[model samples]
Target: MNPLEKVIWILVAYVFGCLNGAYYVGKLYYQQDIRELGSTNAGARNAGRVFSRSAFIVTVIIDAWKVIIPLWIAISFWEMDTIILGCMAIALLLGHLWPVQLGFRGGKGVVVYLATALMLAPIPLVVCGLIILLGYQLHKNLMLIAMIGFSSIPLNLFIFYRNIELTVVFFMMLSVVVIMHRNGD
Candidate 1:
């Protein structure tokens, strides 16, 4: 794709990412802002904790599809390369984490990261899932298990793809997630 097309697709991904499912679900169904409730996080887990299981499920589906649809279109239709896909993924994650309409406060971006990873690397994700299961069995700490699973994505991506560009893109994606979580957002 040309530079202009790349920019446009990245922008499109960001806009779609800005469509926060938790925020909409809370507003439409509960008549409240999810960011103002529970853990004050506009994420599926917090939505489920604050609202209903259905809210969580819906939020997950929405968040996943929001990333998946745009990436799928770019991959299948436009035949975007790894760099373009990486740029779009980063843009989407940034939008999800700091939506302009929501005063730059938004979800933690875990779901967004997973969704992007699902599009970019499905088999590695499954391997990570098994690692997560093992981590869970070894230790019951949610944070530890999550870290173990998430931290492996880059390595797994590298092992599977053997492309430095793709691996670096995913590593950058992983860095974004770690930084966001570390900031307690």
Candidate 2:
């Protein structure tokens, strides 16, 4: 893709990601902003806590599709390279973490990150997901399990792809999520 096309695709991904599912669901169903309830986070967990389990499920679906749909379309139609894909992933994450329409306050970007990870490295994502499930079953600690699973993405990417650039991209995406979560966003 040309430079302009790349920019456009990245922008599209950001805009799609900006469609914060938790906020919309909360507004439409609960008549409240998700960011103003529960943990005050516009994320699936917060939505579930403040609204209903169905809200959480719907938020997950929306957030995942927001990343998956645009990236899939870009890949299928444009066949973007790894670098452009990496940029797009970062843009999507940024949009999720700081949607412009929501006063730059958005979700923690876990769903967006995982959705991109599924697209970029399916095998690693599957392996990590299984590990997360096992860890969750064993310890029943979401935070610890998530930390372990997400931290493994870079190593898994390197092992699977044998490409430093891809590994770096994974690391960058992971860093963004970690930082956002660390900031309590």
Candidate 3:
């Protein structure tokens, strides 16, 4: 594909990623801002706390779909290449980490990360899930568990996909997650 088309797909994925379900659902349904809530995370976990149980489920679903849909369209419909897919994947994570609609403050990228892993490499995601579970049993901190889980994303991509581009994409996404979650919650 041409450079322009790649740029367009990246932009489109970024825009779709910017649509934070927790932020919007909280604002529309509860008249509250998720950014002001626990951890100030515009993701499902905080959404469950600030909004409702159902909101949490919905936000997770939306977050996953928000990334998955664009990826599907690009791969299945547009038949884009894997390298371009990697670019758009990074753009999606960046959008979630620092959405334009929220003045650049956004979630910690757990949903985006999991969705990305599920889409590109399911077995690795499962392995990471086991790591997270084991970490949780040992320490029992959700953030820590997530950190343990997310830290494996790049390696998981490499193990499952064996694509340098995808591995780099997950590494960058994980980097964004680490940066966004620097503060203790």
Candidate 4:
């Protein structure tokens, strides 16, 4: 495809990614805007806070699919390539966090961030999950837990997959995720 076409597809994916499905789901099911509630995020965590655990589960499922589906579509249909898919994943994560449809603001996108990382490389994802859970259990602080998990990305890269490219990708993605999560505190 030409550069113009690639740019268009990327933009389309970003726009689609910014849909805020969880927010709509919350509004439709519970008659509430998730952002107006708990953590004031249009994502699953806050939805789960004000709504039901089931809603949070559903939100996560949809949120994961959002990134996966777009990447899959671009890879299969547009033949854009995996690197672009990674870029699209970041775009989707940012989109979910700052949805244009919702005044360019949304959730923390941690679930989606890890979901993207998992799709990119499973081992790091697993390690990160374990670290986050363990840290949360020990500290009872989500930010601290996330920081521990985020900090462990390099160890996860060294211990599991030794691919330098994968390591760099994981770390870069982790950095973006952490930056996006700055507001979590």
Note the clash tally of each candidate.
0, 0, 0, 0
Q: Which stretches of candidate 4 lie over 4 Å from their true place?
A: 76-80, 133-139, 154-169, 183-185
Local accuracy of candidate 2 as per-residue lDDT tens digits, 12-117: 8889889999999999988999888888888998999889999999999999999999889878988888888888898998899889999998999889888988
How many angstroms is residue 156 displaced in model 2 relative to the true structure, after the best TM-score fit? 0.6
Model 3 Cα displacement at 106 (Å)? Answer: 1.9
Error of 4 at 1 (Å): 3.4
Off by over 4 Å in 3: 159-161
User: What lDDT is reached at residue 88 by model 3?
Assistant: 85
- For model 1, how does the per-residue alpha-carbon lDDT over 33-145 read when each residue is reduced to its tens digit? 99999889898989999999999999999999999999999999999998899999999998999999999888888888889889998887888789999889989987668
Candidate 4 accuracy as lDDT:
0.74
lDDT of 2 at 145: 91
| lDDT measured at residue 58 in model 1 versus the true structure, 0 to 100 | 98
**Predicted structure 1: lDDT:** 0.88
Q: Which digits, one per residue and each the tens of the lDDT, describe model 4 over residues 56-151?
A: 899888888877877777767877765566667767766887788899878776776777776666777778788888778789887777778876
Return the TM-score for each candidate structure: 0.95, 0.95, 0.90, 0.82
What is the overall TM-score of model 4 with all chains considered together? 0.82
> RMSD of candidate 4 to the true fold?
2.7
For model 1, where is the 10-residue window of minimal lDDT? 176-185
